[model samples]
Target: MGCVSRRTQCAPRDTRFPRSQLLQELARYTWPGNVRELRNIVERLLLLTGDAIDAATVRQVLPGRRPSTSGEAGSGTLANRVATFERDVVLQELAAHGHRVTETARALGLERSHLYKKCQQLGIDLKTERTQP
Candidate 1:
């Protein structure tokens, strides 16, 4: 019932918030902000709390979806287009490698650790193409 400023209170705390209350707060929020904003918020929270976050973290960090690149004069922005292309490529390579991270990294000419981080950043599900036994 106090001031519900997500910028301040939702900045992450050692104290855990109740799941129900957090869900309600998230529903009431109008977070038109995109994935970038969510990423920044999550990063800040991670640094602040030094702990793992869960679904309830959604309340503390707003839900965001990147805007679509539709009906633009060209491809919205060069940087965004490049990122999309790169993500697609990584996903393809991952699929081709049967979701084998080490093999995918080698094929992409990347270090395994670097590929892991890149896949995380691109929001690619690393287990998407698991090989059959």
Candidate 2:
């Protein structure tokens, strides 16, 4: 893909990229260059695609990677998808902070109690998490 500048010919249109599929595709990528590279690829995908951004568009933007399965997009409702994403992020942060609730909450920009509430809502058993080897 070419450099994604302001003049990238991307007219304002409603691009329907399903978050569940998009997130799955993004998570599957190795992203050797890290967050910056991921951001650039996303920008390119948005600027290059017409109307909608699907698995094919993602594959074109990110060659060599296997396209996500069709069923991934229909896995759940938008609220469920968002909850899954949030839960995954919370778990990752908790792991990074060695299961310290306070530290995980701080890193996630949430109050400690709020983090506990979030974990409860997400059905994450924090008691078990703390005891994991």
- Clash counts for all predictions: 0, 0
lDDT by residue (1-133, candidate 1, tens digit) is: 2223444365546545454554464456665776555456545544433333344444434533223334553465788767775786686566656778888787677899999899888777666546332
Please write out the lDDT profile of model 2 over residues 20-115, one tens digit for every residue.
676666667776775568767877667544345566556646745633333475478789867875776687678768999998887677899999
Off by over 4 Å in 2: 1-74
TM-score of 1: 0.41
TM-score of each: 0.41, 0.49
Scored by TM-score, the top model is: 2
Best by lDDT: 2
